[model samples]
Target: MKKTRIAALAAVLAFAGATLPASAQTALSENQILQSLQSAARVAPPNLSAALIANAVQEHIKNNPGMPITWTPLQLLDGLAQINVQIQFALNSDIIRPESYATIGSIADALHHPILAGYKFVVTGNTDTTGDRMKNLELSQRRANAVMNALVTVFNVDPARLEAVGLGQENLQDVQNPTDPINRRVQLINVGKYLPGK
Candidate 1:
């Protein structure tokens, strides 16, 4: 199952003309991130509601706790323009590690690119299945919040354009091996356009 997911993700990235890094630690350049995002946005669903998506994830976590999520809701996002990058945090804490600042900065640059200015994004935090499920969920949310806050306050991104959600181990990238570090990641998803007049 994990291999299948990985192959599928690779295929999607390839089709989009994006290259997947060998590991999460490899830094993606601003142009690479920008191009990947732009490609994804071109085919993304129109007018997705970040609030609704956040609420659904929260509801699922509250109801299912540690259970692996089914594909129904996740499938909706599978076709969206999204990229998962590793963001290092302090052990059992939400503090952003200094080494990951470059990656975050690159993401901000991509978000600020002219082509992406009108799009809204979801910043989702995920964790490997190595700790308490509920606690992991909370920690993931805090980490996601931290990243979003940095983008808004430090990088001058519009707060209204981003939403943060934590899925913990519910949607493990490597379902067969829940403890894989690849499961621990921050996903930036281009949800839809941000129209103030709506």
Candidate 2:
């Protein structure tokens, strides 16, 4: 039942166009992020391991070439509750651009919300196919780390609640046009509960 709702939401997000250009992007409010994440979590599958999710992402990238990959690869994450936000970075670098700070702040705010306190999230970075796959993977990791760091250091989010991964160009939002800007995004996925015993 949960899986069904997740799939339906994912389809809507896929078709409704999740990504927006930086110039036209509006910062998602803290309440908006919180609500979307909470709704997603309510219908999310239980006990999704971070390591398993990471392995799936890695396997997807390994099996598919960056330039001609399909949205099919994203099925690994299809039933998860996730949101993609456009996070701008300096050219070929992981430095979060100033314009995106507000968006980052909203993410942090959402993470700090009381209703989401029991959840852990994965910060997955993706890149458009504009450069070497290896290089893009590295940059994406750094960018993901940067966002995680900001959430922890600046917004007081618990470090234990976040994991960062970079998928590079392996999962293109715009598979028909690999180099499309929409392919580059940061995804925040609610992986599971914060298991203190783990």
Candidate 3:
């Protein structure tokens, strides 16, 4: 099952990269990957698949707190799952609802941990499939930027270490039912390597 999930994730990332402009595909950096993923999130369902794979990776990490450093991107993602925070925003708007303050606080706390020093991350926003695709994508991007701003302004996280991207409804958590609430979520993808004792 782990192998299958890993393969699925690799395939999904590959397909996502293939969809980007040729100029953007030459050398894929973390920023490029984030950009490609965001673009794919706007027009394809692969983000949903990526999220599912990430969720599984997170679960694995949760089950084994002593996960080794010699792991794949999926495993590294699972191992560094602190970025999988859930924050709620106002309906159709980038404004975060009051009820989500706790989650935001937790994210702030996690990022402040000593172990995460020097780490760089990208904040990603995803949406359910309910409106115009382009609009949804734009909203997702705005929400992501909002989260990034909140973390930097409110939590004192270094702005240089963060980037925000929105993946619109291109990756619905429940494709068969695009309106599923689970589809709306915020995820943080690390741009730096995980150095356990750093």
Candidate number with greatest TM-score? 2
Model 2 agreement with the true structure over 103-174: per-residue lDDT tens digits: 676677667667889988888888888988888888888899998988788778899899888877776666
Expressed as tens digits, the lDDT of each residue in 58-128 for candidate 3 is 45445534412222223323333222334678878899987665555545555565555546566878776
Ranking of all predicted structures according to lDDT, beginning with the best and ending with the worst: 2, 1, 3
Predicted model with the maximum lDDT: 2
Q: TM per model?
A: 0.76, 0.78, 0.55
| Global CA lDDT computed for model 1 | 0.69
lDDT of 2: 0.70
Candidate 3 stretches greater than 4 Å from native: 1-83, 194-198
C-alpha-based local distance difference test score of model 3: 0.53
Could you tell me the lDDT of residue 93 within candidate 2? 84
Q: Give me the displacement of residue 87 in model 3, in angstroms.
A: 1.8
- What is the per-residue lDDT of model 1 for residues 21-140, given as tens digits with 9 covering 90 to 100? 325333344445565665653465566655666666667667664455442235446657777777789998899998676667667766876889998898988887788887887888
Model 2: how far is 98 from its true place, Å? 2.2
